[model samples]
Target: MPSFHNGAVEIAYLDEGEGDPIVLVHGFASSKNVNWVYPAWVSELKKDGRRVIALDNRGHGDSVKLYDASQYDIAMMANDVLALLDHLDLERADVMGYSLGSRMTAVLALSQPRRLRSAILGGIGIGMIEGGGPGENVAAALEAPSLEAVTDPVGRTFRAFADQTRSDRRALAACLRGSRRLMTADEAAGIAVPVLIAVGTADEIAGSAQALGKIIPGSEVLDIPHRDHMRAVGDKVYKAGVLDFLSRQD
Candidate 1:
């Protein structure tokens, strides 16, 4: 429940275990518990004698929401995390982010490359940029008064989809204005550190998972056979792949 004063925004995070510090970032709207606490990453990393820092981004979870859309951009979001690292006086740490969190992770790599020992970005792609709000059909449904707000079955379903695909309202709103400037395949190529991007075979988000891995040298592409974006975290192959990537650093 503790918080850190990271610039104008205060970030709430879980600081547990001990050893090489690693930060876990969840998708927008989803709390640390939803995206990661259920996953084996925390226990798996901690079991290997490492510290885990799971963050609740502004406007979500236990953290205070930034009413201003501008504050929700990836650059600002990354800074909130950097400030947390500064407050803790740590120089560098490995970062792992899913969906919206992955966009922030990319920004961290670009803006604060020195602070990141490595990174893991999941559930995203350059293909998303081509008129990537919801599809034309869903936009109409989203416009309906009943669908505008979350808390309903359709809204709940969409919320999960959003989390898995970086569709948080404020975050996406910011993205429309280039607030969450996602990197192109070429830009991502500049990042020299070990990076991993994985997707589930059944995920409608992208037709293929292998396409991304081929773009980043030394990067591995993994597909969870029966899982979608929402269920990928629970797959043994997903966990094993990510854990193996991180464990290699030691």
Candidate 2:
């Protein structure tokens, strides 16, 4: 694991394989290893001959933890990705993100389109515009004394995940509270780069993949049949679609 300073925050990341670069960003309460590596994403992508880079967002995994809710704004988190690209001297590369990371990917695609060859948004759909995910209830769940104290279904799921990961619950609470901004339809429509939006057919967390696709001009959508938000991460269909999407770019 290597790290670099994005201002005061230390971001831990893994850079593996060789060839054209593709950065991976994990979801909320999840780290690079859990979200990408354990799911065989790095291995599969490497097998496809890509330079894979994944990072621990600030306040998650091995990255510097911050307790201030104001520090976890979506743009701030997105900037970390930009900083990572700058650190690696990559002027532009394919970028992929899951769940919360999807939001960051969209921000980069919209605000800094020139920095991305393409964008892959997994575990996210119209929620990018309609706005839904871990809300204050999830934040409250993170602040709860224990998972048993979290009764909200969604909250409990995230709390249990945080416990399983042995993450900084307090820091996650702030991140959940701060990184709740949603993009407007105009913003989503503004994205000009090649975009691939993949969501499970059974995913309740991500809205409609087709709906989002319709919003982003020329964007492609891939549906992971019968998979939900969590299970969709490593689905074969999702992997194949991504590889195909990447291949088309070359």
Candidate 3:
């Protein structure tokens, strides 16, 4: 149970492996274990001699949850990551994020691109380019009882997610507020670090991962065919693509 008091929250992170640091940021209603832990990706990277650090963002996993919606903003989340880096005394590291985590990494690139060795944005879409997302509506959906009704259930994806967050609705709702922070194309283009925008061809959530990648300097988009957002992260092709992206320096 490793933790860092990131000024605003105690970010619980899994620090494993050995070599250049690579931070893993998980998406909404997901923990480090759910997103990256079970995938065997961490061990694969460690075997490759790369350091892996997967964090539990505030309001998710073992970290503290703030009742305030403002705390769940992307800026705060990004700051918490920066604080974790500061706590570890690591000046620079590679970053990879998915869904809500991807948005957080986007804000980090915009605010402090120099601190990143490289970046991987997964399951990103054009719908979130405006730096804001649906608010109370998403929050309410998070709070609603699944046994009663679902305004627009996305089939098993919705049910699976509900089960995943069944124990902690508030944290999930807080993460839902984070959807409000989106980055425009021009904003993404400003990032000079090596980047990879990756998504599955069947990922309905990532409406435009390719479009998101094209704008960044020296960034590449890798499409994993026949996979959806939930399944993309575990594919060998996806892992290889991400590894190639991060390993290429200068």
Please tell me which predicted candidate would have the highest TM-score against the true structure: 2
**Model 1 / residue 135 / CA error / Å:** 7.9
In model 2, the Cα lDDT at residue 67 comes to 98
Model 1 / residue 6 / CA error / Å:
1.8
Per-prediction CA RMSD (Å): 4.2, 0.7, 2.2
Q: Which ranges in model 3 have alpha carbons more than 4 Å from their true place?
A: 130-138, 165-167
Per-candidate Cα lDDT values, in order, are 0.68, 0.95, 0.77
| RMSD score of candidate 2 (Å) | 0.7
Query: Which regions of candidate 1 are displaced past 4 Å?
Result: 127-156, 160-180
Model 2 scores worst on lDDT over the 10 consecutive residues at 128-137
In candidate 2, list every pair of residues with a backbone clash.
Answer: none
Estimate TM-scores for all models.
0.81, 0.99, 0.91
Best-fitting candidate, scored by lDDT: 2
lDDT of candidate model 1 versus the reference: 0.68
Question: Can you write out model 1's per-residue Cα lDDT over 1-250, one digit (the tens) per residue?
Answer: 8898776667789888999999988864567877878777788879878899999888767777554656766677777778878888989999988767877887787667789988887765443232232332332333334444544443455544555544345443333243445567776666666777867777765335466566656776666778776677657788778778888863
Q: For candidate 3, lDDT tens digit of each residue in 136-206?
A: 65567667767345564443344457466553776667667654756767887788877788888988776
